[model samples]
Target: MSKDLRESEAASLDNEVLSLLGRHVSVRKFRPDPVSEEQLEAIIQAAQMASTSSNVQAYSVIAVTDPALKSELAALAGNQAYVAECPVFLVWCADLYRLREAAKPHLGGAATYEDSAENFIIATVDTALAAQNAAVAAESLGLGIVYIGGLRNKIAEVAERLGLPELVYPLFGMCLGYPDQSPALRPRLPLPAVLHRDRYDAGETVRQVKAYDATMSEYLRKRTGGAKDTPWSAIMADRLAEPIRLHMKDFLQGKGFLRR
Candidate 1:
């Protein structure tokens, strides 16, 4: 293709992808319709294609479809009803167990680094990337999804219920199904606040964040019909003040992760 034609095609593709990503909204309310097996397979295939560190692909996904199991998980996830109501609940896990098992025969009892902090980081990042890819694929298929971070509220019990072995831990859960409601998109931090040029610019970040606070405040006010107008910074401050998920460090260590 000519240079101009190639550039045109690239821009067109970029526009399509950007449009799909820019409209992202978490759907808490879902329709009664069930997600098909074919759709689920396609989503997982897309997730598997996500980039991984050194191609370790140290992640696993569990799709919970049984009503009873979903109900149990819903309770474990702090009573998030959508966890049970959705057609599919996917538990994304940061897993080193598979890799360890695969290498055991070849190692001849040699020491392994699967328990190192660096490996923990890699597994966590790999799981997140794969899950995001699945999320995007589901959205493209006219399905809606909501991530259930509350799955970590009772991580140990959740892991036990799923029968996860050593070197594996649940990172998060996702509820997937057809949408029953259309919620407004949540506002995000301004691009300038997150994207720095060459070196970190604290002053510019502060200024951009202040501007974003105003944007979020308006969004909250409208969303709640004037019931809330809290700025982004104040909300984040509250989050920091709370001792949220304080058990994570100990829990991860108990799971044989992050030893180093």
Candidate 2:
């Protein structure tokens, strides 16, 4: 194991949180068990405790457990069967509607809640932070999770399905359940490539990326039992070559966000 893969450094730091975070992995396959309502509520409470911008708390979590809903959601999220198979699926939303309604009385028509880019960014940040907290809490309680960015692939249909109003956007979805498989841990880029003392360092990035690509290629081969090809650089290049949700910008515009 590389130094980054070892938990000994985390033990030296003497922080359970650090260790837990260090071992984080995206769990896909799950056991046939359900997470109880009580446990789900606890996870929501943990999510609510995450820091919000100016205490606005511009986020909402929609818990979907109905088999029918999960089935539709799974299909919508590119046929990821694990989504429907998981005990519960959560759609995290960036909710400016609550803030807009709340400001109606105070601003008295002065609040163009739909106009500012800052408010949009704030809601986005808040939703992501809250969802991450829920993920951490779920992991602590022995529940596995995988974030579904594919929710954005059909953003309009997703919003309509979830009954989201203007100023409320579905950011992403998460599937939670007990793990059924223990897959090899994916290696991350080296720390030096990310952390800098004072200013940004560009000189060492290319070398670091090359080395990390090689590491990831080996990890991929091992994890897939030689069934997968090892080409991190090509994978990334292919993904980046395609338009990531080509309609996202226009969709956000229709939702009245990112307007200066």
Candidate 3:
């Protein structure tokens, strides 16, 4: 975190908010220091405090500390070395299996709600919200984290490895530890481009987007020494243009999450 980047926090809001928000940096490099048991407990306590739908708490987190398991998970998740190296790797799951079973007999020995996409969506949203809360808490405690969305690459294998029953799907993984190096803060879109008034507005979207691209390009140039460079739009376009296996539909289907 350089002086300019640190001060860029003011570009968003007041110094207090900037201090908190600016602490977020996706740490790929980590020191060998292990996160203490007490710190881990506090992080989880913060997660448990997050709001849940109907207070059903349809989510669970699995902390992976076994070296062999972490290595295997790293291989499954695009071979991201950080997964294997981190002291803690947490898998956040959209878990409805326990609740579904408990409600089965009460729902005339069948599912309380029809197995459908809507149910899956609810669980997914709940899990995501809870995981984000945990991530914020970890960062606030001086711990670094990187979300491993790539864990979806081999979703079924991961679920099986974790011994997850049907209706419990791995939503995402978070790698955690003491950061070895602090990466630069990535630029974000200007407020007007994303925030809208009463009705939706794209009037200034194009101009704001172009400006953001310029900001990102400049940031990357200074950070990467022009070795690898890309504008935000270009990166997004390339990713979306390709036939990426967002194989989430099939994964959910296999888990019997949205049978309808």
Candidate 4:
């Protein structure tokens, strides 16, 4: 990313892919224009090509374009209007149900969650990689997208909505369409703060964070036209003060993950 683009001192390598990725900003407000079927298929193909753990490809995506369904999902996802308004909403799932079926004949039974932690992590990681590929593909095609992790807020309801079988869990939802609003790129912490010299160090952590917080505060101020000026730490702390999806353990267990 160019310094002119990010307006940050974060070290960046100049390249086609990095330039594309570095300029990314989540698109919340989208135009009502429809994303073409051809574009959607191409994006999915890109997603399908992402690497999977152990070649398991243990994930699936549900494309929801039904207005009624989207409306319900919008409510389920904390009433985020974009969930319903976007031209396409996709639910990415961490899936093992298909694997169970594929392996059933050889094992003479469905696969159990004996390696629950490992399997669960693999599926989640696979799903995220696939979704990111799709997001980048969409951006390349001149579309906009926003990831909706809030889908987890009503996990059971989302499962019901999508008729998701056991061994499948909604990781997140994504809204895609033509962008209606252009948002400023969010700043990131400087490279030295995150990149280590092959060893762990926290000596500069506080200093880097304080400086980054000032940058974030300024960004927020300009972005909101002075309506919001909360610092990054305060905002994150407030978010962390809320439940970190306490139901996740039981829910994933019930969905046949993390049983061990």
Q: Which candidate is the best by lDDT?
A: 1
Q: Write the per-residue lDDT of candidate 4 for residues 146-246, one digit (tens) a residue.
A: 99999999999999879999899999999999999888888899887898787877897656888888988899889888999888889989999988789
Q: Poorest 10 consecutive residues of model 3 by lDDT?
A: 106-115
Tens-place lDDT per residue, model 3, 1-260, is: 45475667656656654576766888898888999889888898788888887887888899999999999999999999999999999999998898887777778654365368878888888888888787888887788999999888999899999999988999999999999997878878998898888977868776789989888888988988886568889988999998765687888888888887
Query: How many clashes show up per model?
Result: 0, 0, 0, 0
- TM-scores of the models, in the order given: 0.95, 0.92, 0.89, 0.91
Ranking by lDDT: 1, 4, 2, 3
Residue-level lDDT tens digits of model 2 in 1-260: 45463555654775667878877889999998989999999999999999999999999999999999999989988999998999899999999998888888888567374658898899999999999999999998899899999999889999999999989999999999999977667888888888877887898765688888888888877878888865677888998999889999889989989877
**Could you tell me how far off, in angstroms, the CA of residue 185 lies in candidate 2 after the best superposition?**
1.0
Error of 3 at 44 (Å): 1.3
Query: Model 3 off-target regions past 4 Å?
Result: 1-18
Arrange candidates, best TM-score first. Answer: 1, 2, 4, 3
Q: Give the alpha-carbon lDDT of every model.
A: 0.94, 0.89, 0.86, 0.90
TM-score of 4: 0.91
Question: Clashes in model 1: which pairs?
Answer: none
Pick out the ten consecutive residues of candidate 1 with the lowest summed lDDT. Answer: 1-10
- Please give the TM-score that candidate 1 achieves against the real structure: 0.95
Model 3: residue 154 alpha-carbon error in angstroms: 0.8
